[model samples]
Target: MKKLEIACFTIASIKIALENGANRIELCNQMEVGGTTPSHEMVTEAAKYDLLKYAMIRPRGGNFVYSTEEFESMKKSLLDLKEQAIDGFVFGLLTEDFQVDISKNKELIQLAHPLPCTFHRAFDQVIEVKQALEDCITCGFQNILTSGLKQTAIEGKEILQALIQQANNRITIMPGGGIRSSNIEELDRFVQANWYHSAAITDGSNTANAEEIQNLKQKLHA
Candidate 1:
């Protein structure tokens, strides 16, 4: 069956996701600028829950490129979160020229070790989608959260489908960005990805809507 992974920005969001039967959650903070790493305290609290959780490892919100200090921060975050009950890690890195920073990404993926890693939306900004997908696979990422380089999954459904076909099950191409119950069926009808991601915030709030999360999961099951 298809799985729904909610982008949870707060502890409340995590609760809502769990209560509503979400398959998994991408836990992070500062949803306004995409997402950054959640605090150690937040991860500690979230770890108490009985759901699959993937912690975001981004240090900031501006771009995929990072300075040496920022990269070090990511490494630190990953190491610290690994001590928690996190099921996996989500992150990505790119060169100034928008190519995948394979070396840096591989380093973090290695640190993540037995736990899988999902290369986040930074995949959208790469200059070459096909090459970047291969790079993420080479870097040991188990999944890639992306919108097929488009603003939203629906708008990019065609490319998303092509990606899935190209991936051929070597890696999971999770379609995220602007995914919601209202449009999930349409997007899935075409893209047919194994996983779908969304914040499930219908009220413009950082917290997820329980009903929205349920609806998204229900639609995926349907």
Candidate 2:
């Protein structure tokens, strides 16, 4: 089935996306920094709903690589929200040289068991994306959020297409960064992916406007 994961930075945006037909959510905070862990209140409230929800587990957004302490914090956050209704958590980790941190990622995925896991846009920063994809698969990622290693999904659509073809249903290739109503229809025609991700933002406010979300759905349907 086709799906959309709205990256909502605020509770208001989450509601707007849900009301406007978003089926899944990537709950986060500090959109300016690529997003970070949401507040406990936000996670608690979001879990009360029956939607497919994933809380962003990023502690700080400078880079995907984490220090020992930072990794410990991510562990704590995941454990704290263990009993929530969240279907999964979105997270990523890489080494200094941009290789997949297979050991840590495997551990984290194991820790997030039962709740499926997603490797977020940190995928875009990897050096060997194809190998990394296989690594995530081995680590048991339910899906991966990426732009095919480009700055935006549109610019990366060619590589995204290749990645999708290579995946061949092993995992979902969710087009994310820089997605908008204006470009999504064209992107759909190009990528033909089953899943798409966006925040439905139409402005710098970083809020998911209901009208924008509706327009996005209509565009996909068209």
Candidate 3:
């Protein structure tokens, strides 16, 4: 059966996602910057949930590239959380010219140790998407979250499909960005993904749409 996974950027939302039938979560902070490294407290807190949790490990927001200090911080954070019952870790590192920084990534991956590692949207910034996917695979990443180099997964479906074929089980290509209740069924059928990510929050002009999450799960599992 197809599975559904949601990305939760906060404590409240993490609980919501799990309660709403999310099988797994990608925990992060500063969703405004497309997710920065979550605090240690947040990671430890998420550990209490039964759902599998993967914490975002990016130190900052501007881009996927990392400085020496930033990389050091990432390593330290992962090491500190090593005792947590988290299922995995999500992160990525790239060169200034938009290439995977394999050596730097290897260090962080090593720190993550037994936990599965996911290459975040940093894959979107690589100069060559196919090469970048290959790089992540070679670096021993278990998955890649991407929108096929376009702004949203909806807009990038064609490229995403191609990427899925190219990945060919070497690594998981998870399509995220702008995924939602109304569109999830189409995406699930089209992408054949066992997992998907979305905010599914209720705020702004969204009160009437608050029930959309329940509807989404029904449709996804139908």
The TM-scores, one per candidate, come to 0.98, 0.97, 0.92
The parts of candidate 1 lying over 4 Å away from their true place are none
Task: Point out where model 2 deviates above 4 Å.
Answer: none
lDDT of 3 by residue, 112-210 (tens): 878999998878788888888888988889988888788888887888888888988878888887777778778777777656666676574211132
- Residue-level lDDT tens digits of model 1 in 67-128: 99999988998998898899999999999999999999999999999999999999999988
Q: What lDDT would each prediction earn against the true structure?
A: 0.92, 0.88, 0.78
Q: Judging by TM-score against the true structure, name the best candidate.
A: 1
Rank by TM-score (best first): 1, 2, 3
Better of 1 and 2 by TM-score: 1
Error of 3 at 169 (Å): 1.6
Error of 1 at 210 (Å): 0.4
**Backbone N/Cα/C clashes per model:** 0, 0, 0
lDDT of 2 by residue, 80-146 (tens): 8777777789999999999889899988889999888989999999988789989889889989899
